[model samples]
Target: QVLCGDDRIDAAVTQVISNLSSPFRSGSLLVNKIEAFEGKELKNVADLSAVVVIKSLADTTVRTVRSSRGQSGAEPVAKLVVPALAPTPNYDAALKQLIKVCQEVHVPLISLPGFGDLAQIADEVRFTFLRQLKLNSTRLHTFLMNLVVEEGLEGLVEEVSNQLNRPVSIESAQFSLMASKNMGGTPASQQRSLVDDVHKSVRKQLKVADSNDGKDWIIPTLKVGKRLVAPIMLGENIVGYISSMVRPNDDMEAIAELLRPAALAAMIEFHQNRQTGPMFAATQKSLLRDLLLGGTLAASDQERMEQHYGFDMADGILVFAASALNAQGQPLALDGLPDSFGVMTEIEGTATVVVPYLANSGKTWQQVAEALQKQLKELVKQKPGGADAQIQIGAGRMSETTFDLAESYREARQALIVGSMMHTNKEFTIGYGELGVKRLLYLMIDHPELERFCEEIIEPLESYDEEWESELVPSLRVYLAEGANLNSAARALFIHRHTLRYRLEQIAEILKVDIDSQEVLLNLQIAFQIRDMMSGSTGKRG
Candidate 1:
């Protein structure tokens, strides 16, 4: 009975293997037996049947298995199985099956050879994955080199082109991708709106609707027309817009994928360059302004100004004092002036109005004076309360030499002072020559001391009012004019020499001084100079 049972068991097992190899029955019968024998009272029998089923399935697939008995008569034996070839058709499904077989036999670390084609496929997939991860040219280059090492350059190029969708050309200097476009039957180069179209396409491709839009997935596309404009964002701000003329192709994908990293780098670099340019320009202008207004200049600075701005020591320079007035004739602040004529008002009490006088003629002073006067008048008239306001100008003379500017400054200041005092409501005034010193002195006739001095000097023959009167002042003046020659003085005065002597003695007696002494002569000369100074007369004097 035991021998018959063993023979029957062997026949049943052989029939099971034959049935498992049949294409239609193999996969189904293996799966059914696994499901049916999962758990039962006949656990050992079920386990043995599961092992037979797994081995039969492994034989059809490119997989291997090793069976062994447990040591010391353990209840269950352990079997090891590994896939000799890479999983066919479905890797996920095949891997799951291999794991299931190992679990049934309680195997550990089943060694299996990878699929025949898995190396190449995995490599390509890895390249694509690495390409996606890279965000710069350097990384991309490294990936390309690795690809070339595994599969030569030509193969790499073909694979990358096929994967990305564009025509890729690699050169020593640069890598480029080219795509043809037909815009309204016009050649891309000749199309006037090519740039616009491209921009629109890029924008559209990148357009993202707001959250209010119901779509769950976002489609990223390059828009080239009015319909599409997608902003390239950096942080929260849009740095630039990207437009593409070519449709997405395998080659184009590779190019764009390559360009994405490069584009980001380029954008950052471009933004930095843009910011730096304006800063540099602003720094230059600030330096120029400081040089012009700082009141001090270095030797190099002076040379630069002279060469670039035509400022030279030989240029005739003058200073002028000017005050703006309102329509009411009241003084207006310097801030009210227009921006022409390089008007610069200093912090000092006065404004140093710069007027460029190109001509070498003496009349440059007059021209500048006239211009200032005109501007002042116009400013006064335009002011709100300028009717009563008076615009006064004091212009200094021009000097060919630079050192004389101090003199010019003094002249202008004096002119402004005297002009303001003497003339009322005049728009401008010139000084020194316009109003004589004698007349100006008479205006101070109320001063008693000056009157007393004049009276004392004209005394000795105050009653002699005639031109021929032998007045003490006239006598002394004549004597001094003749170099203190009594004879010549007497001749000039039409008096006898003795008579001149007697008159001089009388003059000295009245003036309380010696007639022949050097001290008295010096005193008299000083008095004469004082009189001339007070009178503002250039007339000849003894």
Candidate 2:
């Protein structure tokens, strides 16, 4: 409609496409390099460079249009073209035809200064197509709206990234990274580093939650490093979050505006899919603490959580605790190894993992530990500056329900503490059952009944040994510890079997109980443990 052809660079590509007759004009230009066709059988039509030459319709003959208004008909063969766009040709079939048709004939496509120079075309194509588009408000809205028709949150996130020419990420309300789109060409490691920084920023904000007494005090938009973040809030609650990299074309202001509607669209999307509650977790930590501390959930919270995390408390469960040591042998917070294995949380300074157990299906704790160690090794390799870090894991006994998991959680943490004390400078997986007498010592060390029972059982033997100057107590201990084996106890005592038998009989007479009875032997075995603990001896390590 302009009196003269508007020669602005923005309209140059359009003007060149417009010069062709109607059908051909609609086709998109394929400015890809020619060398990209290396593997394919190409019709040696033109010696185009390393990139694609022309992607327009036909090859040799083109019906140029001098007729948009009053004129009509072709004006001598000129511009190149591609498969028609109206009906939208099957891409695969259309590409095959284009390759086949190029067997002969060469036609010059539309050319304009600064836009069509041989050197600038490939750069232009890459700059325009490979990068995120600098979209205006209307175009951005249209782009995001169009993507909503596609299924999944991934499509929406990906398209916003594609058109916006930036890194766009979607995270569950708990700030767990969910989906990401990056067109700015950042390396994966750097991206992960950036994500970590963003997570810290968000968590730093969440720390404010505790002080605010759960009131909605989270900042709506958080700018951390080079990323701009916004919550996808549904009134007072947040369902998820959107984050984008800050840049000239897509700065904080633009990203903030984009996230506003994106949040609504995301909420609508989740709503249409009939999801329940916040998308992931606004109370992720609270839920974690309550369950792990005691596995207690209010009926309403439990029902909603059941629908949210889709887990059943009736399932058998095992709890694990993990700690990492840096190269300097200092403790580092565990790096999501527990998380990769199962539902994970941080309690105190240790990483706690609650893995659903399937005992009815013949699953055992050994199998779980083995699988977990294997996964942990793989995940450790991904942590930065942690190549030399050591991971020490401890697991608790298999539990029958989420309620029982509380004990397992405590045991898991205890195992890590006790395992580190017992197995210094080595990696270990110490189950609660593995601690043996040491566990008993730890639990009953301060119990008044423990000391009373130990005194009652052992005082007679001690008095008898002191009076007669006999080794009855040592011999008795060896006998019970050797599981009442005559020869084993004799060898342990370094005495003849008859000598040990005589001493044991004397010990039985002194204590006024048959040493060979199962109940008597059990008490004596526990008595020896008390003796060791009283004598300041932790149980021996193998």
Candidate 3:
């Protein structure tokens, strides 16, 4: 106020500032010069092109007056100057914004105090900026080296989100989600939409750019990512990215700078993850195998496993074996099923699940297995060829402890095999306890005597059915299974009672056995069981 109140001083100062700020066509002609050095404004100088080079920050925001990563509205000057602060809103905002942008791009932000000529101030700023750049490089170097430690990529993103008051996510080059925080609990559809939009824009850039786009470490400044984003690169290959979860809101350049440390941190994590991911997975899988197949787990491993899963070794577990396929009939991987679904393993194309025999949460192990299957169905439906996927599970009796799991695994496996063989026309979930007489048959599933007995009793019916294109063996098995009741047998076979009676007569005549004898009926039931067991048992039958 005092400076402006003095009319002579104000006039003199205004004239000096105008002369200092302009070099061409200033006092005698119209000022007609513009100086932009590689998309950055040279503050208080007409061409710092040879003085200081500026760094590019992927100009993600609109390349207009608001872009903090580039000089869009401001013009170059011929001498050192600072925008004298004012009360107006536009000047305040622009001045503060330009100061920040220049500081970040390492452009000189010079100030003039008492008694300094324009040339003197310009000389001083050149030296000051050089020193500040060296200092900034050192500080940034230190900040990036120890950016992330034990927090991991997930923790690091969460931390960054907290600091920025915005959501953040890291993803693979293919946009596979790695870590995220503060992204609303929206459905997967919403999440995928967000990723799709961002990736689509990035792909366009990748497609249009020349061959040497990233070759010289120059990533094109994005113009249409709804959120602030930076590529996380390893050499020329983009391993992944660090990005904002929401749309831009004035902190675009600040977010870009913040993401650099995060990208560096993520780079460290992704590098280590790639290096150790498979080995780590193999180790965990092997451990899961040992737990399911009853191999010895070292004491520490056992204790850790017990604590990790919150199951006690003394209480024992229920075993479940499941076979699943995609709609294309390819084996489904169930090991990495989300934790919300109970833990399960895909061992040789079969899901082997073990749950505590009794969960204090009041849920039974069978309920847990059912829940896992339900979740798995939902999970696969999100993938291609998932609607027609087949999933059949079998259960074994509850075991006494970890020591008894092997027996349970064997029972569960055979139950699946035999049930699949018997229920060839439909899907099934078989339990060892529900096998009835088939439980005895499965015990001898690999026995030659069992195979021969089945062949002796049912081979004639099978051959007759094959030759006549009939279902004699199936009808007879159903008849015997229904306690030789003609009405039930006829209903099951979808035929009339008289037809079933005639079929029974043919069976009795062919086998040369009495049709009304209970002894013969029991033998027929046993023979059917043998047929299913022998037909279903594959290699490694127990």
Worst 10 residues of 2 by lDDT: 12-21
Over 78-140, each residue of candidate 2 has an lDDT whose tens digit, in order, gives: 444543433322344434443444433332222222323444565665566434443454576
Candidate 2: regions farther than 4 A off: 1-286, 295-315, 322-332, 338-340, 359-362, 373-404, 410-444, 448-478, 488-496, 502-514, 517-520, 531-542
Best candidate per TM-score, number? 3
What lDDT does candidate 3 reach at residue 522? 80
Q: Tens-digit lDDT track for model 3 on 1-542?
A: 12111222211010112222445221111111111222334354322211221111121222223224335656543443434433322233433454455455433433323132434544554556457655774676455546556667777787788877888887664345778885523333333344345334544555555456643333322323455667664433345667775553353554565676677667777656543554333334344555565455667655645655546733667778876676554655444566444457544446777766554568766676677677667766666776766777788888876667778888888778767777542446778888887777666678788778867876777777778887667778778768888999899889999999888889888788897898888887787667655555322111
Writing each residue's lDDT as its tens digit, candidate 1 over 1-542 gives 12112322332111112122233211111222222233322222222322222211222354344445467755654454553543333244443464455455443212223333433433554455346454444776566555545554344435444544433222110001111112122232322243234334433443433343633322233333321212233322223332333552223333355434323433333233323543222222222322323223345533543333233734665567666555444556543345344333321244445444566655656676776776666655655676456666666666453344446555565566556554444556574344444334545645677646655554333444244454667778788768889999999999999989988887777677788998677556545544554544422232
Pairs of colliding residues, candidate 3: 45-77
Q: What lDDT would each prediction earn against the true structure?
A: 0.44, 0.59, 0.58
What's the C-alpha lDDT at position 276 in model 2? 37
lDDT of 1: 0.44
Best-performing candidate as measured by lDDT: 2
| Candidates ranked by lDDT | 2, 3, 1
